[model samples]
Target: MKKIDNMTVTQIKEYVVTRQKEEYPNLIPMLKEDHRAAVKKIGQNLEKKTAARDQEVQRIEKMKSIESGYYDQGILNIGGIDEVGRGPLAGPVVTCVIILKPDSSRLYVNDSKKVAKKNRETLCEQLLEDAVDYAIGQVDCDVIDNLNILNATKKAMTDSLAKLSIKPDLLLIDALHIDTDIPQKAIVHGDATSYAIAAASIVAKVYRDNLMQIYHEEYPEYGFDHNMGYGTAEHIKALKKYGPTPIHRKSFIQNLGLK
Candidate 1:
């Protein structure tokens, strides 16, 4: 005689499971069918709630993992570095260095490419506010063409780290090691796997995106805003028609037979 409508989904399910067998002796078959229907509805609701909680827990666990690593090292001066524009044909290669607070373990930090753009932008702003130290560095298109992307990226990372107001005791770099006296680790796919690298990735991505948007205003013909200096069909067509711009990497264009 208890009202099922007032009970939560979890309570409804528990009640049904516990009472079904005992009530079978006295209940009509129709009543058992009603119990089955109630149980199914409750199960669906519970599953949805459980899934949402699981996702939240996973995000928390990821944040804890990063926090624990920094705690274990006992070093407050940990810097994360990441680069963007390695694959782009035009625009400068950019890198960012970020030193997060030891106690500020925020969830939802992951690779910039894995996250939505809006979330990346939001996180970039949040990290900037929360970081103890942060800096961005760039190597121009001419320099990228002269040194190549690999070396250019290294230089950008180094420059970003050098500009940091607080010196870092440890450097966590994404995929490339820079020549520095500071202890460093070059982690492959670090942006995807490490929280620190992921934060750095978002900063670098947002910074580079803003720069490309500015370039788009200057050169609307090449669609810099849409392609971000990448070699899309539109970009290639523009290159063929207008020739290389100052921002275009001459080495890459020469290799592609466009220069």
Candidate 2:
């Protein structure tokens, strides 16, 4: 009913913020075209925000189910284990163990391979700050070559578990078995299915990716920065052109017939 056109920019914003949804239809007709568009957009944006918040709540609830499934019998110190770089022709196989709090639930946390690099880094930081306890270990190219990738990954995971300040009562492993005295469950694709495993994957991936970025400075020919030591076509070409660096896993390269 009033001349909204006469209102200042700040007044219009204030009015939009304060106005209820039911009042929008009446107020929209009185406003100019730009203001009307802004009103509709604001309503839509609000709806989207509400939907996203609800989805996040559901995700959090789903993650909590894993917590109850395994640790409901009063086992609070459950560690999730994961490793990265088994397929890489260069760099070490890094592993991480994360012990999340009993009441912890991070909806943003997911399988490291599923998350963006920047977001993975952010989540890794959050895990370090929030986890009850955490540790990382790496099996270098020398060790990987000596024991093979599978054994090397197991060793790295076990080493990570050993380093945890509060030793875990139960372990949730992301696919492979670790040689540890502690109890563990090897869940296929556990990183995607279990919240704790996902946290460990994020931590290990970010940590290992940083190591590859550093290696990029020394081995610029392999594009380690982008591939994170994975054996891509460019990397294979570089291997042929430049030959193997000290970090290159000899056993892995042997398969490429690039001796």
Candidate 3:
């Protein structure tokens, strides 16, 4: 049956399933704004679901049966370590060490940078419940200035490892080696390639983002709420207009003359 222009979007969707799309071109266009929006949302939902499924497949490919590999060698407590806030001009470097049970590995995990913020929060909660053990460490801007970002990040990573209740037999570090005396492997993109690292990355990212949100209230001038201290144009403009806040990294802001 030909779709009439007067049909509601609900009816239009039904007709679309039963008929070729070309038969109902005007039906959707004629829909009220709300109905048109609903139709658009349906399309968007399909794309999101497809993307999620593809991500799952890619994650499996990248992890490459890593969970089984650890188990085969009798390594039960495998930790993945990753950090965030290293590049921000302000705020502390945050690190997380996550040790996931083998069963928890199948959960959706990816590099914190790759996951959307809201989804990362959701994943963070799930990872926490699923993980065998986890710990978070933060080295604030003062410590960062003292030790430098590279060393500060390493220090935070080690701190996180030290706090874990269950000591990890093996460590999967993201692009940096540590002196913890624990055996460790550094993967160039460990967060994307390994479950533990990815989970840790999520924790660190969520933790730091929350900290910046709190900092936003203290120094509203820097636009910390929006830029999260990444030195965006808005943040830089505020820095020039208001000079430096206590949280600003002294060495990092040398060009801005915030001293």
What C-alpha lDDT, on a 0 to 100 scale, does residue 202 get in candidate 1?
91
Measured with C-alpha atoms, the lDDT of residue 131 in candidate 1 is 94
Query: Against the correct fold, how does model 3 do in TM-score?
Result: 0.79
TM-scores for all candidates? 0.80, 0.85, 0.79
Worst lDDT window (10 residues) for model 1? Answer: 24-33
Window of ten residues with lowest summed lDDT in model 2? 27-36
Cα RMSD for candidate 1? 7.6
Residue 96 CA displacement from its true place in model 2, Å: 0.3
Spell out the clash pairs found in candidate 2: none
Better of 2 and 3 by lDDT: 2
- Candidate 1 residue 16 Cα shift, in angstroms, is 24
Best by lDDT: 2
RMSD per model, one decimal: 7.6, 4.8, 7.3
TM-score of 2: 0.85
> Which structure among the candidates has the greatest TM-score?
2
